[model samples]
Structures are given as structure tokens and as C-alpha cells.
Target: MDVPFDLNSYVRVLKLASTPSWEEFSRVALIAGAGVALVGLLGFVIFLLMSFVPGAGL
Candidate 1:
């Protein structure tokens, strides 16, 4: 049996999916960049610590 498509639900979803404004985009970008930088710094610190370990194979 074929399922029927729900046009009403589709329209509702499309309505909710509006484009972000410039300020919203900039705020999101700044938050994302900060998160990435933090993770990278954490990874570098872990690498440095591993290098100091007795047999970390670094």
C-alpha cells in the first residue's frame, strides 16, 4: 500500500525553516568558531601531555 503525503505538514515545516538574519548568522558563527578553537586547543594539550608519558609512542 502506498502512503499518502501530508502537504499541510510539509507547508508547516517550510514555514518554520526561515532564513537566518545577518546578526543571527554572525552570532552562530562566532559561537561555532569558539567551540572549534577550544576543542583544538584541548587536543593539542593532550598531545603534549602524551609526549611526556613514559611509553605513549609519541
Candidate 2:
């Protein structure tokens, strides 16, 4: 038996596939950059802490 297609769902999918406006794109970029910066800062702090340990090689 063949499955029936739903037009409403198809239309919704198409609507969501459109490109983002500049403002939306910029906002996403800013958020992503902040996330990356936070991860980098955390890694640096961990590295510094490890360096102070006696057994850890510099």
C-alpha cells in the first residue's frame, strides 16, 4: 500500500528552509563566538592549574 503525502507538512518544511536575514545571522554569529570564547577561556584556566601541579610537566 502507498503512503499518502501531507501538503500541510510539506508547506511547513518549505517555509522553514528559507535563508536567514542579516540581523538573525549576526545574532547567531555573536552567540556562537561568545560560546567559543568561553570554552577557550576555560581550557586556558585548566592548563594554568595543571602547570602548578608538581607531577604535571610544564
Candidate 3:
């Protein structure tokens, strides 16, 4: 029986993950994504409301 053994890539990723810059960038990305989602939901609700009003142009 023979088992393959190699973890260099995993170790490199782990090391990169420990940097503070990576954490800050991740936070920024999360906030940006949340903002985009909020805007999209708000727009969808507005469209739904507009559709319900009688005589409104489609």
C-alpha cells in the first residue's frame, strides 16, 4: 500500500490567510456585496408596487 503525501499548497494558502491585509479586503468585499443586495431588493419591491397600481404604464 502506498499513500501520496504533499501539503505545500495548503501551507502556502494558510500563510497567506494569516495576513491582516487579506482580512481587511475580505471585510470590504462583504460590505460591498451586502450593499448591492440591498439595492437590488429595494428596486424589486418598487417594481412590484408599481405593477400593482392600476393604470400604471408597464
lDDT of 2 by residue, 24-56 (tens): 999999999999999999999889889988878
Clash totals, every prediction: 0, 0, 0
lDDT of 2: 0.88
lDDT of each: 0.88, 0.88, 0.82
lDDT of 2 at 29: 100
**Leading candidate by TM-score:** 1
Candidate numbers sorted by lDDT from highest down: 1, 2, 3
User: What are the per-residue Cα lDDT tens digits for candidate 1 across 18-38?
Assistant: 899999999999999999999
Which regions of candidate 3 deviate over 4 angstroms?
A: 1-20
Misplaced by over 4 Å in model 1 are 1-7, 56-58
lDDT of 2 at 14: 98
lDDT of 3 by residue, 1-58 (tens): 2233347666777888764598898999999999999999999998988899877746
Q: Sorted by TM-score, highest first, which candidate order results?
A: 1, 2, 3
- Measured against the true structure, the TM-scores of the candidates, in listed sequence, are 0.74, 0.66, 0.58
